[model samples]
Target: MNYFGIIRPAMVTCLMLMLYLAIVVVSLITGPSGLDPQLLSGFSLSPVTGDSEMANVIVTWLLLPRTLMALLCGAALGAAGVLIQGATRNPFASPATLGVNAGAMLAIVLGSVFLPQFTGQFPVVVAFSGAILTTILVFRLAQAISDSPVNLVLIGMAMTLSLGALSAGMLMFYENRLDGLYTWGAGNLSQFDYQPIQRSWPIIGMLTALALLFARRLDMIELGTEQAESLGVNVRRTVGLSLLIAVLLSSTVVSQVGMISFVGLIAPHIARGLGCRKVWLRLLVSTAVGALLLLVADVAARLIPLLISDSHYSFPAGVMTTVVGAPFMLFLLTQRKRVSALATTPGETGIQALFHLSPVTFLSALAFVFLLIFGFSLFGNLDLQWINLRWPRVLSAAFAGAALGVSGLVLQTLTRNPLSSPDVSGLTTTGVLFVVLGLVLFPGLGSLEMTLLSIMGSGFALLLLLGLSRLTGFNPLLFALAGLCLSAMAATLISMVLVLGSNQSSEVLVWLSGSTYAVTSERFYLLFISVLAVLPLLFAMWRRLDILQLGEYLPSLLGVRIQATVAILLVMVALLSAVSVAAVGGISFIGLMAPHICRVTGLSSHRHLIPATAMMGSILLVGSDWLSRTVIAPFEIPSGLLVSGAGGIYFILLLLSGKYIQRR
Candidate 1:
């Protein structure tokens, strides 16, 4: 390396170390109890003696431990980030992006709920187990989808959402029992004593050292598997070791600190941006940078309580990380040097090519739908009389699923990208956010009023996605990134509202989870009528969709009103998405899955694709709803979760099939 390269990185590292120390001092002095300037006068004496005794007590018991824990956790995260980014060969890779933190949080929450005794004592083990499982799942899914960074991150995002939903559902279900879990879930850095620090530091120190040992191998692996292998590196073992170290470091912090967001992601990136590309130097700089970033965030978390004048409203340090991290992620997305387009083959075909849907097949599909409705509605019910009352539930599931399926089909067609869907494109989250906003701003707002706001929100989100995609050239990865960013923003907004409006949050949570249990006749008709009117309109525009499918320029050459046609269809998608969100509360992936399945089955024509997708969607959601109701009988799970989880898995399968992997 050049002298300047070494000197520059070393200088940055030193500066960062100094900055971290400065923050540590600041954190040590400031607390809920005001800092005393006179405490500095007693530096000559023992810490526990002299005029600084009270100051020593405050620093020793409270600030000292918390600050130390932050430093340790931040350093671990920074090292883990470098390891993950190196192992994945993706600059964007981090603990959060790989679903490690979410997985760890899920395990921790579940343990606290079901295995309370063991969790309180062995949280780190439980957390590590969860993180390991999640890491494996993410890697498996990424392997299936292609080792492309975008694909891995996409799968990771799906995993994060699925795991997060599971955690949220569990927490909501046991809301009464899990009193302190919420604050912990948000990742508080407050320390009553030094127990966490005492228990945590040794493990962190060892892991950091282990990570450094892997630095040279990681650098080789970054050269590509073939190159690394040629250079006498065992690529698989290195990757495995790297991932294990990364997961352990990250999960350890999560176990102790709840969930510190973005430290892993930003630390390594900042180090690399500052010209620290050599593995060892980058690791050191990243560690210091992470410590500084987190210490600053913790300080802000402490000071914000003072600014707000409400100690009860103290912002969790984790929340602040996300607040900073999300926009940074978005900026990184826009900065991606290149992205591969989804693969296209002439005359695409799916399972439908093997078995033609004759009149009998149509009848069979219809019979199956009715049977699903019956199975979901009447099966195992002690009260047969209540079968009549279940029609609303059945209809609600069918209507919402059908709407989402058709919406997904419309989005895929309009975008000419199979990965495009209402949920993935962010319409569903936007709609849910709008409804939540309505509920917060107007507590007495009826379903009708909320539905209107949802439609507006979905439309706005769609427009925003389109605008951003225009800038990104409609690259599927960028599109998904935009959607994820929008979703995160919406989720953050919902979290804030929930924290502020604690009393009514449960009702909002239920709606966001996409439950069918609350389907009243009014809501049922609203969704049912909306689907009935829109499905036929969708059919009428099938020819236009087909024409547009020929390519944008060709369609215009063929006299298709491209702009007006796209605008109308997209509006229809927004409407359908809003209706589904209104009825089922952000049911996702159904819109992505149903149409994808149909297209894979060789139904390429819009005529076949749209209706087939709608039918499949109806089946998927009805079945999901059935599972939701019966999975833990008498206590329903949200159909949305089942659909989202299944769809995410199916999407991964498609990626794993190797057809989607673009050769450079």
Candidate 2:
């Protein structure tokens, strides 16, 4: 309304745009060629005269294509985000929410794994298909449930997780085929020919036209469905059009670049803050902001190593954007209390009973999971029909499953966050890194030492989570965003270590997925001790945890030392997570879904929730392991990957069934 407001936002927009362009220029110059800064600066003034073929090729071919690709992809994603959050009125919505990215990922993964001949061109088509399917799934799922903007978002998240897991598992089934897909999954924008963007440009253009045409409807609808309807807007038709355009704009971009996080969340908010009022202005501003944000992230991804000599770091644009966007969003959330996304409410109070076990049913379910796991493990690539039966293999799968199951229980109990899991939190991966570091630094160290180091990593991760929670108000969605960011960071670091030109450390990647390749009686004994130790501790703290779950204040009045109890439980969770990580690889999401399964099965009490979560986790891991090993014999998938695949479905099912509202 004020002159200063108009001038300030315009100035900020101009400044950010200028800064973004400069970064792109800088990123275009930086690469793995080890080009010195002086040479690049010199080359800038020098026109294309291919005198030095290598330098010319690097600059003209590689750098130029890459930079342009980054700019386009970034802008597309950023605009996509703005369209989504604005259209849905949910901050949590992103390309990933609507399944666009994951569906695209699934298509690309399938191309690599199942259809090798089409690897080059198939990824794009597959990605497009995935994105389209994703939009349909999200809208349909939301329609089937409630059409509240928040419910659509939750459905999108559910679809995303399910599809993403399916994609990962598909890749695993064809890892030998899809070995180098992680970078693509990381949102690599290395090689592009401008053809794909051109193909989708028409769609993007149509979307822009629609957004502008329906600008007034958008402004009216943002008020609320009923309000818009009262104002003579055809709320249903306008929303349907908005949803269609948003999905098309989003998925088309996702088809090119794998899912880039936070672009959508950051862009529109920035655009509006910068004084864009009209729906068309917001969309346009968001488009420019999104493009610049992505370009800057890509450029920075390239620029970081140049700034630091001897640095060997590289990040995909998507990961880098998320890493930057998550904290900024958190800061924004804290500074302003009023929000558009789903709001959290404290849970209802009651005397939640712990005992919900029916001996006949519990045992029956256990038997079923056991029999299925046993049948699969007992008859894998390692045959045993005429030969003597191996007790070790059977026991190994069982124990590992049990470890995960229990780990999930411990984590869910500690956090009181349903989506909380060792896998979801990235503790499993971080813990693995630490354990590996310990093993490498102190050769021939005991299992206990490795486990201890891993627990330290897990504790460090939990502390990081706590600090993040404190800063971000501990919203589950934000926590998930942080976890995604952290996962990318850990993956980037791991990729660096794995490719360090040595087979010795490289081999540890086997455990990156849940595996029992070197299982021993001693290892099992340690796991047994860990499970026994943590179970009783969790049980002891049951009442306090229940009280703590009753929102943050009431526990203190119940004569509980809230801070101390939380600290201890947090440490215990780290211990449990670290031990599991040491035993298996960095499988995530089991902890998140296990607790939900428990709660859904009518065991909300900590006492029952704890044990139930562990059992559900065990069942999931064991079952996934069985599928991994048996379904595709002689080509074993990682147990963790498979569990994630399964758990992703369970997560989606929770959304479809409305169990998500309880957690939400």
Candidate 3:
């Protein structure tokens, strides 16, 4: 049949196959140093010497296997994406989005760290188990709430963050044991031989075939559950089987390549856009598209070094895919038809009755803060030398945390989204990215300069997000998705910098994970002044913020200049987040957690909630700082990492409780 009366399906298929073959040939001929002339000579197993032998070895052992592995893994991920998206009836669904890849990677990291021998023995089993279990958990939790596609993705995102935090923490603490694993974790496809391909292809092939067999059922189910049931399809059974196949396929790929993202997500969309309507046809096209996409990405990864004249530095193909895919996701969000279809129900006004903060509760919070400060100050040694070194660190964490908390509250109020925060909104990542870029481009920048760069980056990111989100009238889900895309792109760029063998990789990693170790007196003072500067403005806007929470219409009716107020508040958030990130790296979730915690305590008035949130944030981070310093003693963990772990768990629980309350 002709597609759109412009192209034939068979012709499209043939074109895709031909393109794939051409790219495969290109991949084989290419290397870090470019094309090899000797590769034109016929293959020889003879004991040839010099260029021919070197070329033969590189082609046969390294380039060929890596290329083939990329094709196989890409095909597997593509098929898996189609399966999950079909089963969930969610266009945004993919193995990465559903937490399968993160789960698998986390499990493998845990096994390798805690049970090295066992992990070394049966790595595949461990990966598969993690992927399946996490998928089940995400699905169950999402099901518990509602079957809204948006909710499923949100829950999956939370799980992915939680799992990722655990994986990062383990790798950081056990860096000695997991050396070079970070490169692999970032998704490496380099191969020394064919063993990985030899072992994994069969499983990948079998899983893809099984997924295809369910294509008809998936198509029926897409007609709606009742319609599918009437058509004699066992909807639940089909979904379960499809998900299982998807997890297995994805985990198999992860076990070999370690978290290649967005292949599954990008491939199916490309196939469908090419007018592949039938489920089976779409699956076939998607698999081919996925393989081709990954092969091209690998080629780009190899060629990047040549482009930059930096032959010594190269990064993972996964980074290349992410850099490409993130923008594509934003493009998808901009499509009016897709945005309308994914439109979410308005968020409920949770816990209407606000209780007064009792004196005991206020005093208890104060006591906790003082105790944490004191403990953090005197935990190791009480000498003057120790105090001189330690006080800066403690105050830095406190001030930075308070800034983040207040920033988060402002963001939530302005966006009218409870989940809104600097980190979640991509402001933190953008700020961190700019600071890292500044450090790379112009090393030895002072604290003030770095903070300026950070604010500039964050403000730019906010403007970009707001511009794109305007197309959808600032719908909360779409806004969040846009921020997510921005964050992913920023993060991928940072990873590219890290993988380029930067001299500051070690320090950057530590700081990126939210270490307070390097915070000096000067840096602490800079953060203190920035936070203090923003407070008076925040206090003046408290009434305006409260009016905003009642929605934009009411605020405008009340004679509040809504646009000016929101613009100013957003600027404050960017400044606050920027300074905090400059001081302590990307300490996340404090902004998210602190605001929610304050709201839960019955403080709805911005007058009361603002300081409460700031206090809560300070206590949380100071306590995290104390634990980070004390837990491993001489070996300090990044306080940001610990907070992220706790925050991820808290975020998930918060989602569940909110859903339950809404149901009630």
**Clash totals, every prediction:** 7, 8, 0
**TM-score of candidate 3 against the unseen true structure:** 0.95
Q: What RMSD, rounded to one decimal, does every model reach?
A: 4.3, 4.7, 2.4
Q: By lDDT, highest first, what's the ranking?
A: 3, 1, 2
Residues 334-451, candidate 3, lDDT per residue (tens digit)?
7878767666535543433345576457647766766657575556576888888888888898889889999988887776666677887889999999988888767788888988
Positional deviation of 107 in candidate 3, in angstroms? 0.4
Q: After superposition, how far is residue 440 of candidate 2 from its true place, in Å?
A: 8.6
Which order, best to worst by TM-score?
3, 1, 2
TM, every model: 0.85, 0.82, 0.95
**Using lDDT as the measure, which candidate wins?**
3
Error of 1 at 543 (Å): 2.8
In candidate 1, what are the lDDT values of residues 316-404, reduced to their tens digit?
77877876876777677665363333222212212223334553465456557756665755554768777667777777888788889
Using TM-score as the measure, name the better of candidate 1 and candidate 3. 3
Shift of residue 429 alpha carbon in model 2, Å: 4.3
lDDT per model, in order? 0.77, 0.64, 0.82
